[model samples]
Target: MSLARKFATVGGATLGSRLLGFGRETLMAAALGTGPMADAFYAAFRFPNLFRRLFAEGAFNAAFVPLFAKEIEANGIDGAKRFSEEVLGVLFTVLLVITIAMELAMPLIVSTIIAPGFVNDPEKFDVTVKLAIVMFPYLMCMSLTAMLSGMLNSLHHYFAAAIAPVFLNLTLIAALAYGLWTGADPLMTAWYLSWGVLVAGILQMAVLYAGVRHAGMRFGLRRPRYTPNVKRLLVLAFPAAITGGITQINQLIGQMIASTKDGAIAVLQYADRVYQLPLGVVGIAVGVVLLPELSRALRGGAVKEAANLQNRSLEFVLFLTLPAAGAIWVISDEIVRVLYERGAFSPATTATVASTLAIYGLGLPAFVMIKALNPGFFAREDTKTPMRFTGISVAFNCLLAVSLFPIYGERGIATAEAASGWLTTVLLFVTLVRRGHWEWEPALFSRVLRLVSATVVMAVSLHYASGYLADWLTPQARLLTQLTALMLLIGMAMIVYFALAFAIGGADASMLRRNLKRKPRPETAQEEADTSVLPPPQM
Candidate 1:
């Protein structure tokens, strides 16, 4: 499959999940607002979500895909199957250990780590602990799902893993619907969401397991064993997990700091869901595909192909994310109000979330670029370098957030995260260049500058369009009226950006066709001649 198609497959699926997630968040705003229950639910959920990214998605994809590809190459499907079962047994056992420990320590964890601020509110503290315990098992389910997902990605079956997240959003939405239908109180609504998370985790795993089986790689349960292979995977995965979850780590750091203020955690989460649309679509798609694809290339000693893939991935990411960042930055207030201003989401809350969203918008490209760039190291089995950068970023996030939070409130945390993200992105990019792992193409730089120009134009256009819609986008406007205005404003921005991108040489149809469409390998000189042309611009 063409890289663009692969990205589209995953990104399209992620786009579905993210869209459903928007509905879920909208419902959540109505059901919980930024109340004690909302803060408690989001804060508790962040723990397992953080671990899911670290242990399952980040760690396994970084450490497992390359090694799994090696197993396939060295010993075929059977060896790969054997390696998978071994890892699964250990993963399952370790997850149980972690879950049990976490469940037992939920109270302490919540009081100290998850939300120290809740301690002063005995009811909120207890609610957070119970909810966290109920949902901690989600970590186990998603960890197993990640193992299955890594296998599927290595085998080039992207859809199931990518689409599995839709179930989480679906289940949560259903839960919210039920809660609203029953007119459940905030506390009761939160319980529904927590249980929904657990159910979705199980459903998501089942989907991936089915995908793995359909891909013709079946595994039998094995007794827990710490084989040499498992041990090596652990060594690699420990660092990779940290590296893979730098964003989550930074969020958790922010969460702890934000918790000191009531509703700050939930406010950050509202803004987070908005920004996560582009980040999840473009960022997760790039990270999921790049690692396995790049690993296979390097493993076969196709260094140039690997470099080309990285270059193209970077280009494609910027093409999509730059304008998204622009739109988010330009109309953040409208976006927030249009989506979440009804029900318990008041105008004041909208203003707070909008500012936070705007700050996060500035970091969108860097966040996605970090996902694009890290694979350059992980694909080569150098997880430690990225992990070191992650550590540095986390430290920076902590220091900056602490220094600024008191004076600036939640916006301070947002600023810190954005700043930290850019720091990590620059560090990763420069290191890749210095280590000769990346080849800076002159054309790629030229295209990026052009894309930036297009984004600036689009931002200005969006800014003016938003101003024109200022009246229609108000809190007193009918929901449908507000939504229509927001859509038209966004539609104008997209039209302007894409038109400018093509007219100004930032992108072209031939480039899309070249990257998104694949042709059969030519088998003859005449065929090769017919196929001959300048390759698509990298990314």
Candidate 2:
């Protein structure tokens, strides 16, 4: 498949999921607002999600996909299918044990891991524990889903994996809708939301499994075996999991520190949700598709082709992410208010969330850059390098959080996050350069500089326009009209930015057009002849 088409397929599905997620969060804001109930629910929901990133996104797919791709390229589809079954059998056993243990220790895990926010309010703490218990099993379900996703992605079936997240958002929205129609208590509704996690996990796995089967692959419970393949998968997975764990730990630490300041945790979470939209669309889609493709190339000793693909993907991320960051920074406040200012989310809450969003916006490009670049290491099975670098980033985050929380409160926490993100991005770049894995690309740098100039123009124009529009956004003003106006202002800013970018040669519309118009280039089928630890054939 063409790279652009692949991205479009994944991005389209992800955007749908994100929009549905927005609906879920909006309904949640109306139902729970910024209160103890909301805090408890978020805290409860975070536990499984934190682990999901560690195991599913971070460890499992990072290790599994390259190996599975190699097997497919070497031994054909049937060989890869057997490898997947073995890996899945082992994965289920391990994740099941971990889930049961976590469910049993939910209370202690919440109170100890990231529990400072609940210390002052015992009731909220108790409720958080209860909800966490309900959601903890979601890790098992989602991890399995991730394995299934990795398989489908290897088969070039991005649609099913990308669409799986939509089910999650849909399940939550369905729960909230049911609660609203039935007039249930908010806390009970929050509980229902927790239950939806399990439901969504099951649905996501089932959808992907069906996709895999339709792709002419089948998986079943295999007799547990300690094959060399399984051993290598475990060996790779452990450090990879630790790497994912470190990143998760950074956010958990941020949460723990922010917890001491009431409402701070939720503020960061909401702002992150907004920043993550573009990060998801541009960064994640590239990372997911690039890793497997690059792995196949690198394994086949197609160093030039791998490097070319990496450089091209890097440019794509920088070109798209830079303007996205600018748009987010320019419209942070208006975006927050427009999306999240209903129900118990008052004007003050809007300002707070928006400010946090702006700070996070500053780091959006760096965050997405990491997503694009980290795959370079993972594709080569060099997960340890990224893991070590991520550890340093975690330390930077913890130190900043401690020093800033007492002075700047929640905004301070957001600032710390932004600072650490940029720091890590720079550090990673330097390390890659030193290792000769990456070199200075003058074209990419020039594009970034041009993007900076365009942002300045957009920001200056926005600063002027917002002054005249502020008066029409009074508290007594109709929220819908005011929100529409706010979006119009942002839309105008985007138009100016893009127009300036094109004029100044910061963005190449032809490149984007070519990317979009490209078609899929499928891999040539291989015979079941070899199973080496090295790479596969190039397309």
Candidate 3:
């Protein structure tokens, strides 16, 4: 498939998943609010969720996809399958052991590592521990699912893997609905949700495994042995995993700091959910498609093609994210109040969440840029450099978060995250340029400048538009009125932004049109032969 079509397939599915995620968050806001129960549930969810992101989504795929693709191209189907089986055997064994250990150590982890603040409230602390234990098995399921997803993506079957997350949201939403209908206690409802997480993990893994099978790859469990390729994969994956772990650790630090204040953790979680929509849809989708594509291009000695793809991906990300960041910053309050601020969610909570979302919005472009740029290094199997950069960013985040938390509270934590994101993006960009892995063309730079200008125009328009609808956005406004005003405001802002972008030469209308119409490039024998001698990826 064309790059744009692959991106759309993954991006569209991700959009569906994110929309359901928003619904799930909305229900949770109404059902649990920012109370202790909400805090406990989110805190519990955060522990396993962080590990899942690090191990399953971020690090594993970064290392797995490129190698798996190389194997498929070079060694054919059977070679790829054998490699996958070896990796799976070792991976499953490791994950199984870790899950068992974590389950046993849940109390210690919850009390010290995950949410130390909960220690002051014995009930909350105990509840968090229980919920975490219930959800811990999700780690194993998702880690395995991630491996299967790598296989599917390598085979150019992106939809099933991309859409698997919707099941998680669906499962959670159902649990929340049942809790409400049955009038279950808040703690009981959280318990139900934790179990739902486990079930969803299993279901998501099953879906992806089925996809891999349908793609004509069947994996069976074998003795846990690290064959030569598996050993190479592990070596490459270790640094990437460390990088992912550092990112997660930064998040954990923020959560720990947020946990000191009542309801701060939940507030951060809610804000994160809001910004994650754009991040997942654009940033993640680009990363997913770009890595394999770049790897293939480079393997085929199509360096120019690889560079063009990177430039286009960067342009697309900025084009989308800049406007998204602007709109979110402009209408954060209205968005938050409309989506949340119901039931037990108070106006004060809404305001806090809105401010947090605004700060996160400021970093949205940087976050997306990181996603786009990292693939440049990763596709060439240069995980160590990114790992080093991630370390620096995480250190900065830790120091800044610690310094600012006393003054700015949860907003400080959000600010630290945004600042660190930009720092990481800049570092990655500089490294890429220095290594000649990425080059900034004049057109790309000009377009980026124009995109920024267009975003400013959109922001100014949204500022006034929001003022005009201030009454409808108020907490006391009817829900329908609030929703209608918010939707219209967003729609108008999108129209203004795109129009300004096109007028200012910020966007390439023809390029996008071509992207939509471009045909898939068939794999050539020369390309396969080129990949046959693909040297083992550098550590």
Candidate 4:
């Protein structure tokens, strides 16, 4: 399969999920606004996501994929299947215990991890605690889901895992809509969303289970046991967890600092949702497809091929993500207003989120590049180097956020996020170069410069459109009207950018033209090619 095809398989599935998520958040903003309910819900949401990142998705994947790939290569199908079952057995027991314990300790977790939002308001505080307890169990279900996802990914079944998140968004949307229709309290609706998360995890796992079965891999857990492989996985995962924790540490630090200012945390959270859409789509899709592929290459002693995959992954990511970053930066306000300004969401909140979104836009490509690059290290089973770099980058983020927060407030948080993204990218590049893993190719550099130049043209054009829209902002303007205008303006900006990019040899014009020269499904075929993973072991 071609690289583009692989990306499309993952990217197309993920694009659906991201769009649904946008709808879910749009409804949440309409229903809850930036008030107490929003705060409580986001807080509850973040707690599970933190663990999900640190364990289920992050450290686990970093450590598990490479070993799984190797076991399949050396020990064959049954060996890899046994390894998976053993890992799942131990993970289920441990995560179940952790979930119950965390639920029991929800109050303390909320109070310390991100307390300031609810500290002065007892109602918000209590609601967050209860909601968090309901949501905490999601970790257990999702942990199991992640294990299934990892297995499917190792088997090159990226579609199932990529498509699974859509169910989560659909569940939440349905829950939120039901709550609204019934005229229930928003807090109750938030609790329903929490339960919806657990439901989604189950559905996701079930879907991947089917995929695994189709691929002729067994999916089940035995009674818990700490086999040597399990123990090795546990040991390897600890540092990988720290490496995974690095990205979230920026958010945690920002949340802590944002707590000092009224509404800042919620503002940051809202903007983050917008930022997460693209990051989740491109970054996560690339990471998921690349990791197991890199693992297989490294295990087979194909170092040069592994590097080539990295290089191509870099090219593919830069091709797609750089423009996305540019578009978001160009129309941050319109994007915010279109997705958010309804129900209780005010114009002021839109403005706040928009500015923060712009800052986040600046870092989007770097974030995706980091995602694509990290697999190179993880596939080599060298978690320590990335861990060290992540630790340093996260520390830099903390210092920058602390130094800037007093004056910049929420924007400081945004600035810190952007700075940390670039910081990590630079560190990773240096590490790769020093180790003789990565070096500049003139063609790649030239392509990147073209992308930047095209994006600059896009940004300048969008800036004027934004200014023109500002003239229409009046107290009497309806939210729908403002949002509609914003959408139209953004659409215009994109058309102009696409046209200019093609004219100037900027974007993926040549690729698109060549693709057009092929049959109708050419893009789809290319996407599938890019997503190919390890060949399943012989029966």
Candidate 5:
């Protein structure tokens, strides 16, 4: 399949899941608002979710995919299956031990890492601890699921793995719908949400495992042993996990800091979910497809192909994310209010979330840049470099978040996250350039600048369009009016951005079709930098 098609398959599925997430969060806003119970649940859930992102989605795939691809290359499906079973046996055993340990240490975790801020309020502290225990087992299920998802990705069956997350949203939405229907109190509703998390984790893992089977791989249980392969996986996985899950690590740091203030955790989470839409669709989609594709090119010693993957994927990411950041920055208040400003979500809450979302918008491109760039390292089996940068970014995030939160509150936390993301992006880019992994080309820079120019025009237009729609976006307006006004703003954004991009040579459908329609060829260095809409970069 073409790169764009693969991205679309995964990105389309993620879009569905994100849309469902919006529904789930919308109901959650009504059920819990930005109340104490809301803080308790989000804070509790963030722990397991953090590990889920770090290990399952980030670490497992980063370390496993290239190796899995190698097995496929060396010995075909049977060889890969044996390697998978070996990893699975060890993974299952390790996850079981970790779950047991976390459950036992839940209180200690809550007191220290989970939410030290809640300790003064004995009631809230107790609730966070209990909720975390109920949800922490999710980490195990998702970690295993991550393995299965990686298998599916390596096999090029993107849809099933991508679609599994929809079940999580479906399960949670059902849980929330039931709670809201019963008019349950916020605490009871949070309990429902926690159990929903556990159940959804199991469901998502099952779907991915079935997908692996369908992709012509199946396995039974094996003894958990530290084989040479498993040991090597561990060595690569630990660092890759840290690098892959950098965003979550930074967010976890922000969460710890945000916990000290009432309602801040949930507020940040709401904003995080909103911005995660574009990240999941574009950034994550590119990362998933690019890793396996790049690994294949490198494995075959196709330097030109690998370089094209990096540069073309970069083009694809900026093509989508720049305008999204613009939209979020331009009409954050309207978007937040439309999605969240009802029930327990007051206008004051909307203001805070909007500001946070806007700050996050500034970093969206950088946030996704890591996704496109990291594969440059992982495909070559070098995980430590990205890990070192992640450590630097996390530390910067911690220090800056601490310094800024007292001054700007939640917005300060947002600022810290955006700044750290840009820092990481610059670090990754410079490293890739210095090492010659990334083909730093002037045409790419020209396109990026053009994309930015187009985005600025769209953003300026959106500012005025939103101002004109302010009355319709007000709380007094009917729900339909709010929805219409918001949709209209989004539609205008798409129409304006894409047209301007194509007109101004920021994008070329023909060139994209030519370059990304197939893997790069040895003779296509000129094609890689064809003077279609713009000339090739000066050497």
Candidate 6:
């Protein structure tokens, strides 16, 4: 499949998942608000979510996919199956051990690491510990799910793996609905949500496992062993793990700092959900599709092909991300009020969340660029360099957050995250250029500049449009009225952006259409020969 079609498959599914996620968050807002229950539930949830990113989605895939793709290319499906079984055995064993250890340590982790603020409230703290323990096994389930997903992506079976997350959002949304119907108390409602997370993990794993099987690959776990290929995967994965770990730590730092203030954590989570819609759809979709495609291209000695893929991915990302960032920045308060200012979520909380969303929006492009660029290094088996940059970014994040938190409160932490994201992005780009792995062709640069210009136009349009809808986008307004106005405002901004982009030659609708319609060419003999010798495993 062509990259665009693959991305569309993944991006479309991700869009579904994210839309459901917004529904889940909206229900959560109505149920928990920015209160003690909300704080405890989100804090507990963050622990497993952090590990999911570290071990499942972020580190493991970066290291696993390229090697997995190479195995399939070189040794065919059977060889790939055997390698997968060995790796799965080791991964399962390790994750099981970690999950058990974390469950036992849940109390300490909650009090000291996850939410120190809750320590003063013994009941709340205890609830957090229990919720975290219930959800800890989610890490195990999802790590295994991620392995299955990596396999599917390498096999070019994107839809099932991509759609799997929808189950999670659905599970949580159902849980909330049940709680609301039962008129459950806040603590009981949180308990239901926590269990919902665990059930979702299991369902997600099942779906992806079925996907792997449908793709005509099956592997049973054996006793964990350090075979050569497994050892090499671990070596590459360790640095990527550290890189992911640092990113998580940066987030934890922000959460920890935010925790000191009542309701701050929930506010940050709300804003995070808002910005993550775009990030998940565009940035993550690009990363997921780009990694395996780049691996195949580089392995086939198609360096030019690899570079072009990176450039095109960047172009497509900015095309969508720039206008998104601008619109969010321009109408953040309205979006927050329309989506979340109901029940316990007050206008004041909406304002705070809006500011947080705008700060995050400014960093959206950099965040997506990081996603697009990291695959370049990962495909080349150069994980350590990114790890080093991540370390630097983390250190800067801590320094900035600590320095600014005392002065600016939650916004300070948000600022630090945005600043660190850009730092990591710039460092990655410079390194890629120095390594001769990426270059800014004139055409790509021009489109990016044009996209920025178009976004500016959209921003101005949105700023004016938002003023006219200000009354409807308020807590006093009827919910339906707010929704209608918010949708109309967003639709108008999108139209303005696209129209301006097309006028300025920034929009390439034809390129997207052509890419979607393009068919995969058969591999030539030279291409086969070029990929025959896999690069030596980095010990």
Q: Which candidate has the highest TM-score of all?
A: 5
Model 1 segments more than 4 A misplaced: 515-539
Q: lDDT of each model, Cα atoms only?
A: 0.91, 0.78, 0.87, 0.78, 0.91, 0.87
The deviation in Å at residue 64 for candidate 4 is 1.0
Task: List runs of model 6 lying over 4 Å from the truth.
Answer: 245-247, 514-539
State the lDDT of candidate 1 residue by residue for 1-539, as single tens digits: 89899999999999999999999999999888899999999999999999999999999999999899999999999999999999999889889999999999999999899999889999999999999999999999999999999999999999999999999999999999999999889999999999999999999999999899999998988999999999989988999999989989999999999988999999999999999999999999999998998887666555656677888889899999999999999899899999998889999999999999999999999999999998988887788889999999999999999999999999999999999999999999999899788988999999999999999999999998888889998888899999899889989999999999999999988667674333323343344344433222111
Query: TM-score per candidate, in order?
Result: 0.96, 0.93, 0.96, 0.90, 0.97, 0.96
- Tens-place lDDT per residue, model 5, 1-539, is 88989999999999999999999999999999999999999999999999998888888778999899999999999999999989999999988999999999999999899888999999999999999999999999999989998999999999998999999899999999999999899999999999999999999989888888888898877999899989988988999999988998889889889889999999999999999999999998999999999888777666777888888999999999999999999899999999999999999999999999999999999999999999988887888899999999999999999999999999999999999999999999998899767778899899899999999999999999999999999999999999999999999989999999999999998657866754666566455445212111111
* Candidate scoring better on TM-score of 5 and 6: 5
Worst 10 residues of 3 by lDDT: 515-524
How good is model 5 by TM-score?
A: 0.97
Over 267-355, each residue of candidate 2 has an lDDT whose tens digit, in order, gives 77777788778888887798778878878766765555565666677777776777677767776777777677787777788888888
Tell me the lDDT of model 2 at 182. 93
Find the 10 residues in a row with the least total lDDT in model 5.
530-539
